[model samples]
Target: MNWRRLWAVMLKEVRQLRRDRITLAMIIGIPVLQLVLFGYAINLNLRGLDAAIADQAGSAGSRALVMDMLATDVIVPVREARTPQELMALLKRGEISVGIAIPADFERRRIDGRAVAQVLVDGTDTVVQSAALQLAQVPLDTTPSANAGPLRDAGLSAAQRISVVSFYNPERRSAVNIVPGLIGIILTMTMVMFTSVAIVRERERGNMELLIATPLSRSELMVGKVLPYALIGLVQTTLVLLLGIWLFQVPIRGSLLDVYLASILLIVANLTMGLLISTKARSQFQSMQMTFFVFLPSILLSGFMFPFAGMPKIVQWLAELLPLTHFLRLIRGVMLRGAGLFELWPEVLALVVFTVAMMALAILRFRKRLD
Candidate 1:
């Protein structure tokens, strides 16, 4: 290689990169975004988990135990349930992460030195469950009856024990938690990247102008572009699901029909997002940058790689805006917890809203580009 010629080519490429402001910004911005997400938003220390209490004993010992659990600042009881069914219903709806049940004979058992309280944890999220288990154990080390003072003075043995039970992934296998979520992450990445480049490539090659010149309406053109990809998304979803089942031994606890239906909604949402990116991007490189901009948050904030509840409140609010976040919740709920439409309707509604909003934006942006 000629040193002079190589230096000249390198200088030319440097000038080209300097002029491409979007790429330049991405080079600086992507790292900063990653730092912010990883340093500030990503948290492994689980705290302030949503908890529900079913106190059947209604005694001083039971009240003292509840207070002790809350004082740990790990599990925050948000609701009270009258029965076990109500507590389980809360868990199924993803409303609470942990449930505490004090049996009717809890006081009697504690007096006999064999008190047992039940702690039911949602084990779909292994990280959260692990932290909850540790937090739940804190109360067991102390005697709730002794803390009550009255029970201790009554000559009762100050001892309390808790039985911890996990739902969904009873064994706390990471694969069972991760494989179902991988389905959504894979779909989001592929669908967004694929559709983001589609219209931009057409425009880059001078095909979009010809298509626009035809009698075909913009909506028709958009639909035509998206339909095939939507079908492809379905195929991809099926393949991932099968692979997860075969390789990871992940069980599908809910109806396969529910999973398919939810997958379609999620696929459409991501495709619309990609089309929107395509409309805004002037080149394939810009499209790819924008795709990564979206993709990073989808993986990070969507609870695909980290626990959603572990993030701060503002980050959790931001996570709610991501379609993948909602889809992860939906897919995980169906696959792990046997949750149905009734349990997952909120996430389903969020996906529907996301699809409509993205489609509208893409259509508007493309029309303006045409003008």
Candidate 2:
């Protein structure tokens, strides 16, 4: 209600933030570094995947097919085996992702127009399995599918055309999905952790009483305190996204407007949560430890590393309560899926609710203590 008092408190908070250069650098520098590292290291499309071959026929046709696979850049032949049993043993030992078995009658069958080859692939890892399947389907010089009748005339049979699309991460690349989620994690962790320090430092310096003597209400005071941190969170998001685009070539598929709106909502809510924690915390160290506990689940339960579907029922239920989980889904849906508001309304709604709820709680806690 008091505009002048709110602006005065806002200016004070901004001045204090400006004085803290180390915290500023941490918020701005780290996100960019993470973006560059993750962008280069994470690949959904596997390349030069290690594999083995079992060539029972040792015929010229089979050898040429093997060479063709190697040339495709998907599979790199690591070892050769004389029998299927040896190839199987190697696969079980984790030595290879794909195993090509050329039948003993491969050349004879090709001459007789009855050629067939077996491709053994390790399906334990989804990304590697997808890559292996594609590598195996490479046709050898022996196929004359153009002349083959009806079922086989299409060059690929029903089974061969089986479409495998990696959802959430269609390219099956970790970085594409991961970098977006990391933005939310970094924003949540840094904003919450540091904003707690803002209030805790005031308490430590015995400045809370002095600041409370001013005309600012609890809501105005909290807004002023959190606004500078919110700006920092915005800067951090920008640095990370720019690095991802320039260094990693990560596409920004959705409109920048949607991403911008979602980010503001999420950041404000996280900073509010931080303010609430500071109200309860007696020391900076306690605030940090509590932030850590909150961050761990936010990272794990948010489906950052593992698939949500693969997690147990309880874990899945827990994930639903986390803001980071919804934010991650929204970020990925926007960045990778090019999803608009219509497609992302559920996630958008969750973020809006979370921001409002957390900010309200922080305000009530601050006001309750004041009385």
Per-residue lDDT of 302 in model 2 = 74
RMSD of 1: 3.4
In each prediction, how many residue pairs overlap at the backbone (N, C-alpha, C within less than 3 A)? 0, 2
TM-score of each: 0.91, 0.58
Per-residue lDDT of model 1, residues 1-371, tens digit only: 89999999999999999999889989899899999999999999888999999999897768878888888777888888988889999898888999988899876666544645778899999887787766446434234444433333334222225667889888888999888888888889989988999888997788877886789877887777788998998999899899998998999989999999988998899999999999888899899999999999989999888888889999999999999999988888888888897788899999999999999888887862444
**For each candidate, what is the lDDT?**
0.84, 0.69
Query: CA RMSD for every model?
Result: 3.4, 15.2
What are the per-residue Cα lDDT tens digits for candidate 2 across 1-371?
Answer: 99999999999988876776544555675576456424543345666766787888886667887787788787778887888787766554445656777778766555444434666665434455566667546764544445533333335432343222233344455567567877898998998898777677787888888887888888888889889888899899999899888877777878888777778877987888888888776678767766865786677667676544344456567778788888876776677656665566777788788878877887787642332
- Choose the strongest candidate by lDDT: 1
Q: Worst ten-residue run, lDDT, model 2?
A: 158-167
* Model 2, residue pairs in steric clash: 44-172, 44-173
The alpha-carbon lDDT assigned to residue 261 of candidate 1 equals 90
